[model samples]
Target chain A: MEFSSKVLEKAVNEISQLPGIGKRTALRLVLHLLKQPKEQTVFLSQALLTMREEIKFCLNCHNLSDVTICEICSNKNRDHKIICVVEDVRDVMAIENTGQYRGVYHVLGGKISPIDGVGPNQLNINSLVKKVKSGAVSEVIFALSSTMEGDTTNFYIYKQIQESSIITSTIARGIAVGDELEYADEVTLGRSILQRIPFENAFKNY
Target chain B: MEFSSKVLEKAVNEISQLPGIGKRTALRLVLHLLKQPKEQTVFLSQALLTMREEIKFCLNCHNLSDVTICEICSNKNRDHKIICVVEDVRDVMAIENTGQYRGVYHVLGGKISPIDGVGPNQLNINSLVKKVKSGAVSEVIFALSSTMEGDTTNFYIYKQIQESSIITSTIARGIAVGDELEYADEVTLGRSILQRIPFENAFKNY
Candidate 1:
């Protein structure tokens, strides 16, 4: 009987190890690579090797970096006084894409998921508390996902810094920016109701 | 503004260079790696590194292997008389997955695409012809894709080996095995009509 090339199989195995890729997708990718220019295939393989061997974590915030402190932490112009805590580095990219934030970031590595046996101890929470206690930071923003594990992690961090004087905040929960009120999901409507604040309380300059 | 970690960014860049991966998908994969256990992450990185550094092409058939020859080429029990010529290592795989053919394979490295400036000289056709000329081969199967380039390649090889005594054949093309007649696309239906064989003689034994 016929059998696939062991090298192609090995390449497929390595590609399939990525987050969303499966065996079939990996095979397709291998086929595509075969059809691509030889230089492109060689470059991609070399890039994977270099990334695995060269890149490392930032010692300060536990984010990925080539240096001890990440670029964000080392930049003097960035606002070190404000820090945004997130579940992963991808969250940092998401917020950055919005062009609204101007603060350094601390990646918790992941959220607390008891079912997966991940807890506060598994994350870099101590480093965050230490950063807050340093007195250099004035505000800490929790910018985690809205999932159950994310909420549990947010609450844990909140309790950890409850006695500290640094102002702590979570991302607002309400109708999403572009979403129509009439088309709002039940969960979003419910959360908006519970977190509702009084309107028209302050005097307006007429 | 908040930013992704440098190591994560580097990893995403590397992953996105693979066939079919985009920037957003690469980010998702990087985040997934961060969520995995340290050992798992380490294993995946090491696997990628090893795949690039350890895998080598078979000296004989150009298949991937850890040593001088691939498993298929090294196997003594398989048919050494019949060689199936294909465009790449992946075609060897597609044929292998069917578990039908007992012949060995010769990967041409690529097909003949004049617009892309690919010719027989750029392929492994020289090695294939040499292998056939050695007089150990009886039948040579051109199991290439049914495309313009593939047809041009087959014709080129046929002309080059016109004097050789080996019998040559191609994979049959007709209504695909599992395709419904009503839903069959026009191109496939036309090809089936053009290549129609005598069913009366084919069913004589039955």
Candidate 2:
């Protein structure tokens, strides 16, 4: 799409570079900014720049942090002995939102995706192994996605710390709690049946 | 949702202020930026700031431009005597994309919407009337949306220039080209029948 103004064209190009945003959507957003107060643009730009310039990674979990260690990893109430492994800070935030898990996190930065040229060496695997081998951890929970890359990363980390006597586990995968069984996909339904739990175990908190 | 870092939280808040973006989506975009090279964020911010600070509106047409008069209004090849009145620069761009019209444009900035506290005075209506009164224009095409507000604005402008000999007309409303008759809405289909054009004229641009 052609723009009447060079500045508008440049702004649209930059805004559309973001994921899930198209040129048309960027144009609409830029035009909206033009209609608002000039200070709004300054605030937005400054916020983005400040975040990118000063953001730091947690020393222990590899999650985003303002300091060396993130809040969850540094909190005394969180069970540091029980580390919940995740792909990135996004997963850590998602799990934290549930409020069910009280354990600290070990963010891997990413899963083992060879197609993307991401391997075990490219992740925070070594730091996690060192943490487990230190014998300060009792249990290691894998909260990675249920994809091939997640499984591979989980197994790779499990093998590295297996000799350290850490109780390794993964979050359970099945149909959603409130979903109807009739509408469940065949693979998930079959897996749920094969891995059925004890009747009493399903009502742990409820 | 809580963010681990203050900078991340601030960035997410600012980004989510844009239309159609939510806190979760903003967090996702911010995290994606974190994963990229820091220069990308700097570039994006700079482009937006420059556009907002240096952008100008064309004096004659009120369309976005880097100069006093926009490219369309200044172009000698375009028929300046035949002005197409539109809602905003977006409409001008949309019409230009069709490559069908050679006339210049007059951007109204917005239509008359009393409920939204927007009246004719809030638009670029007077400049349009003044341009017509100069006796340089022969025809004025009303290319605004087919909404009630659009029609009201068109009628108001037409009344203002009625004393002059300038021909005032609105875009044709009917079922769209290539649309199936069976699925056509009653209002549009009925209007198309009532405003039926000459059979040979329909084939002019086919």
Over all chains combined, what TM-score does candidate 1 have?
A: 0.72
Residue A143 lDDT, candidate 2, scale 0-100: 91
- Grade the docking of candidate 1: acceptable
Task: List interface RMSDs for the candidates, in order.
Answer: 4.9, 0.8
Candidate 2: which docking quality band? high
Fnat value of model 2? 0.85
lDDT of each residue in B1-206, candidate 2, tens digit only: 87899999999999999999999899889988988999999999999999999999999899999888889989999889999999987898899999989999999988999998999998999999999999999999999998899989999998899999988888999999999999999999999999999998987861
lDDT of 1 by residue, A43-81 (tens): 554554455556667787787777777778888888888
Error (Å) of candidate 2 at residue A69 is 1.3
For the predicted complex of model 2, DockQ is: 0.82
